[model samples]
Target: MSRQHTSGDLRADRRYAYAEACLAEGDAAGAAEMAEQALDLAPRFAPAWLLLGRAREALHAAGGRETDLQGALRAYANALDLDPEDVLGSRLRLAQLGVGDALAAISPAYVRALFDGYAARFERHLVGELGYRGPTMLCASIDALAGAGRRFARVLDLGCGTGLMGATLEGRFDRLAGVDLSPAMLAKAEARGLYHRLVAGELTGFLAGEAAASADLVVAADVFIYLGDLRPALAAIARVLGPDGLAAFTVQSHDGAGIVIGPDGRYAHADAEVLAAADAAGLSLRSLTPAAIRRQNGLGVPGRIAVLSPGLA
Candidate 1:
């Protein structure tokens, strides 16, 4: 169902639809006026609030009006308050505006909703348009550390969206399991039949339910960008890995001391933050090398592929 339909008012829905059409036609002023009317009729409509916020943001971009930006912020805050799960991703917008602290992690509801909507076009857009090579590059990083043709008895693919990583490591593991937040993504992965099992849940929560030392290898390709603080997930990965197990993942890289939420709504981590988190989680960093995970805005995004093993106490 469309978000506008949830308002339960035919008139409000018509206004909202008109607002969306105006926005799509680059008529921000018209959209804003119509959205305001929609809000007047359905004051608590979260999607209308989001549309108003976006229209105000567009106007601010064109006119450079501080008041418009502030208005956008208030609209977004109202939407977030009405939908704390943040299915509309207002928190990311707030972070991009530099008005809110980078969230420790993106809300699962947001991720799930985003991927569910993008599932059908994800691979084409990511691989063909964005030139995403995260899975292949991460696998190469693992092979460089573990030696080519190294095999594992059990492997876990964290945030295993569409099983891209699983496809890369198909014959390299005796057993493979996957976990992801989006049911739509998991359904695609299941269709690939590369994983022995595919589960749908948040990464850390899924890891918490697994047996200690159960996985011989864990891989997260282009997954950590949604996470600001890496400690919790790192610790959970450590707990789930066997003594000889290794964990490998890719993260957007930055030069700052900690994590930063980029304007693109992804988290970029400094090397210091990643090292500290791995050390705290009792994981030995075997490799941390510069790489390009994907392309954004016609440029390669700088990133790091880190491979880690269980550290002795």
Candidate 2:
């Protein structure tokens, strides 16, 4: 069931709407004032709190006011207290501001909402503007390691946004199945008729539901960034893979010891952490090659393409 807002009062809702409009119009002070008024009327209105937080953040950015930053933090904290499921993504905001420890994992609701809104322009912006070539890069890595004339019986595409990877591996696999969080993205993938099945759910959850040793190949192109800890997902992949099955994925890399949430709200994993996670999951690392996953802000984002197979006793 969807979460219900605390603001049952119609007047409070109207004030919140006006605050949102003011924020959109670049009037941060006005938005903050209106949001405060809305909150006064309906103290538990989480949306109003979120708006107030955003307005304070804007004010802080504009003038570097410590009080504004503190206000933003308090407002975000209040929203999280009212809605711990993080429907407003207060945790993400807090992490981005360096005010708290990064979340163990990004909220699935946030990822779904983000992709649902970005589905229409995802391909264009990612491929054209950001120079995203994750799918192509993963396929190239596969060809280099697996050699020519290689094929798989069944393939699972995790986080298969718009079937870009499916399109790349169209004839290479006998059966193709896709899993993603966003129905809108899945709809676009379905329109291409590239996958035999498409499931709208979290990656690990979908993998757990599949029959054991069912997939010969599992691929997650540019998807691991949303996942902070790789152990659970890798364990699920290990469980679902055939004896000779291979799991391939890309992850943004960091020089530190563990995963860290970047300012962009994406997680970057250290090489050590990834290797340790794979080893713990009883998977043998076949390859871990550095590559430029995509371009962000006109610069190449450093990442790794990893291939793992079932470990031998």
Off by over 4 Å in 2: 1-27, 62-64, 99-101
Give, for candidate 2, the lowest lDDT window spanning 10 residues.
1-10
Candidate 2, residues 61-126, lDDT tens digits: the string is 999999999999999999988877776678888888887767454788778877888899999999
Relative to the unseen true structure, what is the C-alpha lDDT of residue 110 in candidate 1, on a scale of 0 to 100?
88
lDDT of 1 by residue, 1-313 (tens): 3422378888888899999999999999999999999999999999999999999999999999999999999999999999988888888887778777675437788888989989999999999999999989988889998899799999999999999999999889999999999999999999998899999999999999999999999999989999988999999999999999999999999977788888688999999999999999999999999998899999999899999999933
Alpha-carbon runs more than 4 Å astray in model 1: 1-5
Best by lDDT: 1
- List TM-scores for all candidates, in order: 0.95, 0.89
RMSD (Å) per prediction? 1.7, 3.0
lDDT of 1 at 109: 87
